[model samples]
Target chain A: MKLLLLSNSAAPGRSYLDHAREVIAEHLDGVTELLFVPYALADHDGYTAKVAAFMDTLGIRVRGAHTAREPRELVASAQAVFIGGGNSFRLLKSLQRHGLVDAVARRIRADGVPYMGSSAGTNMACPTLRTTNDMPIVQPVSFDTLGLVPFQINPHYLDPVPGSAHMGETREERLRQLLEENDVPVLGLREGTWLRRSHDALELGGLAAGARLFTSGAEPVEHAPGADLSPLLAAEARFDCRPD
Target chain B: MKLLLLSNSAAPGRSYLDHAREVIAEHLDGVTELLFVPYALADHDGYTAKVAAFMDTLGIRVRGAHTAREPRELVASAQAVFIGGGNSFRLLKSLQRHGLVDAVARRIRADGVPYMGSSAGTNMACPTLRTTNDMPIVQPVSFDTLGLVPFQINPHYLDPVPGSAHMGETREERLRQLLEENDVPVLGLREGTWLRRSHDALELGGLAAGARLFTSGAEPVEHAPGADLSPLLAAEARFDCRPD
Candidate 1:
C-alpha cells in the first residue's frame, strides 16, 4: 500500500496545495484519475473545485465521492483515492453515514490503491481518529478509522506558544494522556511536513522541519524531514503502563 | 441555583485557584461541605488534595467523588458541587460511567445546589460538551452533559495568534461550525474570566478582559467583565438557519 499523509495542504504565504505539490505529483505518479472524498470539507463543492484545479497541474482528473451513486465502487475503481482535510469528526461521520469507511480502507490497505490525505484526511488513515485536534462538534459512531498505519497521526501539530496564558493541554500533554488510555504510538506531524509510505517503507518529508513521535515509555523523539520512520511502522506496541 | 463557571482555575503567574478566590468564596458562601468531581484530572488524588487544601482556606470541607462509595448519594446530599477541569471528554465520560450526569444536573437545576466548574468543569455546565477544546482522547456514551445552562461555554477562548501559520480552524471558526449544526449559542470565556449565575441572573466576571458570544448568523459580540448577560438566559433560541 502507498500513502501520502500530509500535515496540511497549505503553508503560510503559500498557495493552495503549493507546499505539497512535489509530493502529490510523485505519490500519484502514473495515476490519470483520482477519487476525492470531500466529506471533511464544509464547502464540498468549493473544496472539490480547488482540489481539481490543483490536480490539473499534475494532469490528473478528479471526481467527487459525494456525488457518486456508489461511493464504495468509486473507491474500489479509483486509480488513487484522496481525502481532503477539514473537520475530522464530520468527515468520519459522513463516511460512516455513507458506509464507505471499510471500503476506502480496503482499497488503500489491502487492494494497494494509493491513498493521500491532508489534515483531517490524513487523520482518517490512522487506526483511530482519537488523535485529531478537531472539536467533537459531531460524534461519529466510533473513533475507529482506516488502519492503514499501526499508529495515530496528529496532523498540523504546533509547539505551545511561549509565555501564552492558555491553560489547555499542550499537544504533548494531550498525547501523553492518550498513551495513558491506549498503547498506540502517536506521530505529531507539524504543518508543511508529511509521512509517505511505499509498501513497507515509511519516511517523513516536506519543506518544514520535522515531526515528533510519542511512544508510551520514551521521551517524544523528533525526526527531521526526509528521515526514515519505517521502524515505527514495524515496532511492537510498547506501553509505560501494564497492558489491559 | 448558584453557578460559578470559570474559564480557568488560575491565571498565569498566579497560584492554583488563586485568581478565583473571591468569586469562589462568594459563590460558595454559606456552604459547609462541597463535593468535588476530579475525574477530569489525570491525577485524581493530586487534584482532590489541592482542591481540598484550597477550600480549607475558605472554611469549607471538600470530599472526593471518585473515592465515595455512592457518588450519586454524595451529589444528592452535598451543599455544593464542583467539577475541576482537565479533559472535558474524560470528565463527562467518568460522570456518565458513574451514573452521576443526571444526578449532578438535577442538583444544580432543581435542588438549587451551588455548582462550580473551571475549564472542562465549566464546559460541563453547558447544554452540551460539543464546544470543548479538549482532545477527544476517549469517547463518551454521548456528547450530552449536564444542561444547567442555555448556551455552551468555550473555556479558555483565545483569538488566533497573529501571523501564526497554523491552518487549522480558529476558535471562532470551530464555533461557526457548531452553530451550523446546533442552534445553541456559545459563550467564549477567555482565561481568567467566568460567568456567574445567581438564580435567573447571569453575569460575566473575573480579571480577564471580556467574553465573546456567538449566535447563529450574527457576528460574535464581546461582553465586558461584570456585564449583566441575564438576557442570554431568557432569550429564546434564535437561529440563522431553520430550527430543528
Candidate 2:
C-alpha cells in the first residue's frame, strides 16, 4: 500500500496547484480504492468541489470522498483513500462521527488499500494529530488516526522565529522536548515536498522544495524531496518511506 | 472500560481523582490494572519520580510504568491506561514507535480497556492532534494515535490572544480551524479541568478550572472549570503523578 501526505492545500508547496496534481496522481493514476478526507478543506470551500472536478478530469473512480452524508459507506468500496488538507482536527472529527474510521482501517489492513493524504490528511497518519500546528478550536475525541505512515510529519516547515523575548516556548523547543522524551524520527517537509511510505521504509517526495528528515537515531538530513513517481506505476505493489 | 485523562503534570485534577475513586470503589479498585505512560516525561528529571510517588501515595501498585522504555507488554496487560502530558508530539511519537499504536487499539477494541490521556496525553486521545496550540518543531512520521477519546482536546484553555503580530498561528486560530474543519466536538480543557466519557455520554469534570466543549453539530458549552475539584471526585481510587 502507498500513502501520500501533504502539509497544506495550496498548490503542493507555494499555494495549491501542485497539491492538486499530487492528489490526481495519488488517487487516479495508479490506485483502486480512493478516499479523500478534507478536514482543513473547510477553510477553502472550493477544496472538495475542486477535487470533485479534478476526479472528473482524471477519470478516477471514487467510492467515498465526503464525510457529511452517507459517510461510512464511502469507504466501503474505496481502493484508495485520499485525505485533502485544511484543518486536521475538523477533518478527523468528521471521520469519527460518521463512523468511517473502522471502514478506513479495514480497507488499509484487509484490502491493502492505497492511501493518499495532503496537509491535514498527512497529519492524520502520525501517532497523534498535535504536530500539524493548526489552530486548536475544534476538538475531536482523539488525535490518533490511520497508522499507514510512521513518522510525525510537519508539512510546512518554517525557519525559527525571529527576535528574542517572545518568551513562550518556541516551536523548536516544543519539538525538541518531544524528541527528548520520545524515540522516533521527525520529518520536516517544506512546501512542495511530500513523504511516501510503502513496503518497509519512508522516503521523501515532491520536487517543489527541499525536505528535512530528523530522527532520534541521528542528525537531521535535507533533500530535494521527490522523484518522477513513475516508479510507482503498478497499483498492487507496496511502498515504504524508510531509507534503504 | 474506565479511562482517566489528565491536563498537565503539575497537578492531578481533583475531579479526575474523584471520578477514578468512584469507579474503583464500584468495580475496579483491586481488580484494576494501573499503567502510567510518561511518554512526554522530559525536561524535568523529576517528572517520572513524581508520578511514581503519586502512585505510591495513592496505595495503588504500579504494576508497570514506562519512561524511555517501550511499554508494549505493559500496555497489553493493563485494563486501563493513563497517559500523562508533557509535550504532545513527544507523547505521540513514543506511542507510535513503541508499537503502542496497535497495542492501544487492541486494548480499546478487544479488551474494552479504559484509556486516559492528559495534556499531551489528552491531545493524543483525539482523532487528530491538530487541536493543540503547541509548536511544531519535532515531527513524528505519521499523525496516527490511540482513538480512545472522540474530541479534540485543547488543554490549558485561555482567553483570546490580547494583540500581537506573532507571525506564526495563534493558539485560538489553531483551535478555530480545528473546529471549522470537522463535525466533532472540541474540548477546551483548561488547566485543572477535564471531560469524561461514560457508556455513551460525556461528563465535564474539574471545578477549579472548568473546561469548554465545542462540537461542529452544536455550539461550544463550558463544562465546570474551577479550583475546587471535590465536586468532580469519584472516590476511593488510588492514583499517582510525578515530574521527571
Candidate 3:
C-alpha cells in the first residue's frame, strides 16, 4: 500500500490537479480504498465538497483518514492510500492534534502502503516538516511526520524573483543552505513531476522533471525525472530519524 | 547611518566588491566610514579573498565593521552599513556565534542607522531568518534577525527548469505560503532590485528592473524604484513575529 500525495485538492477547472489525477490513475489503476486528506480545505469556500466531488470523478472515494479507529487498517487493506494536498501546516497540525502522526508513520513503513503525496501531502513524508515553503499555518511543535521519505521535497519549484529589493533568500539558495547544513537530499519538483524511490536508489517518476541531490563533497546534480534516485534515497536512509 | 543590503554577490564578471564601489559612489556620494558584512561569504569557494579584493578595489579606504568590540559601536560610528551577499545561514550563524544578533538589531532600530542589504545581505534584515530559502549550513537556533525589514525577500527571481517532473509548489506557491503566514507584505526582487524602509515605512528603490509584493486580501502588485511602501511596512511591523 502506497500513499499517493497530491499537492492540491482536485476540483473543477484546475489543470494542476488533473496532472495529479492522471498520475494516480496510471500508477494505481486497480487500487480502491483511499484515505483523502484535504486538511487545507477546512476554511476554503466550497473546497470540501469540491474535493469530495473530485474524488468521485476519479473513482476513488475520499474520506478523512482519522475518521476510523484504525485508519491504518483501511490504509493497509486498501489498494492504495491517497493523501490529497492542501496546506502542509494545517494538515500536519490536524494529524498531530488527532495523534495520528505515529499511526500514519507506522502504516507507511510497516503496512506496505504506497504513499503518493502532492504538495502538502508530499511534505508530510519527510523527517521534519520545517523544509516546507508553505506559510506556517500551524506550528506542529515537533516537525516529526510520516518519515517514509528522508529528504525534503520542494514542489512546484520556481526560481527567485528578479530585480526587486525583497530579500530573504532565493528558494534554491535556501535549499542550498539546507543542503550545506544537513546531509539530506532536497528534491525540487515542479508541477506534474514526482520522484519514485525504491530502496537505496531514487527514480524520477512523473513528467520530465529535474531534481537536485545534495551531499557532502559532491556538487548537487540536477537530474530529470525517470532518472534513478534509488541510490540517493538508499544512501540517505542510513541516518536515523532521531532529532539532532 | 543606513544599512545597504545586496541580494547576491554580483553579476558574473562584476565582482560583488565592485558593487560596493557603485553603492559607495552613488548611494553614499558624500558618506565615509562604512562597515561591510559578508555573511553568506562562508559558503563561497574563496570568500575571504573576494572580500579582500573587494576592499582593495575601493579607491578610498574603509574599515571592517566587524572589528568593533560591540555591534553597537561598529554600527554607530559608520556613515552607513553594507552587507554583502553569500549564504544566509553562514552569515547568520557567524552573527549569532559572535553574539551580534541583538547588537545589529539595536543598531538598526534604536540607533536609527540607515541600513541597506542586498542578496544574502538583504535576507538578514527580517525579524526572523526563516524566510530565507538558503540551505542551513549553520543553525543559529533562533530565526530572530535584525528586524530592519518586516517582509521576506525572494531575490534572483529565476524560472523553473523547462520540462521537469519534480512537480510541487511552484515558486509562486512558496510565496503564497509566505503571504498566508505573513499578514505583512512579501517582496520578490529580481537582480539589481531593492526596497528601502525608513520611518516605519517601506519604499521600492533603485533598479529599473521589476519587483513583486504579496499581501492578504489583495493581489500582488509590482513596484518600481522609489514606490511608497509605508502602508505595507507599517502593517507588517504590527504583525506578531512570535509563532502561535
Alpha-carbon DockQ of candidate 2? 0.17
TM-score (chain A only) for the predictions, listed in order: 0.95, 0.76, 0.80
Better of 2 and 3 by DockQ: 2
Best by DockQ: 1
Candidate 1 per-residue lDDT, tens place, B52-147, comes to 999999999999998777789889889999999888877888899899999999988888999999999988988677889988877778888888
Q: List per-candidate RMSD values in Å.
A: 2.5, 11.8, 6.1
lDDT of 3: 0.60
**True-vs-predicted CA distance for residue A244, candidate 1, Å:** 11
- lDDT of residue B205 for candidate 3: 55
Range of the 10 consecutive residues with the lowest summed lDDT in candidate 3 chain A:
A235-244
Top model number, TM-score: 1
Q: What residue runs in model 2 are displaced by over 4 Å at the alpha carbon?
A: A11-15, A19-23, A30-34, A39-46, A61-70, A135-139, A162-165, A226-244, B1-41, B45-132, B135-172, B178-244
Give model 2's docking category. incorrect
The alpha-carbon deviation from the true structure for residue B36 of candidate 2, after best TM-score superposition, in angstroms, is 22
Candidate 1 structure quality by residue, lDDT tens digits, A60-80: 999999777778878878899
In model 3 chain B, which range of ten residues has the least summed lDDT?
B235-244
Query: lDDT tens string, model 2, B1-244?
Result: 4555555445343433343344333333454346777656553346555554555545655444554354787776776676777666566665776788778767865686777666777777766665655644344565656666554567777645566423334555555554444445566776555656554545566545577665544656656633232332322211111110
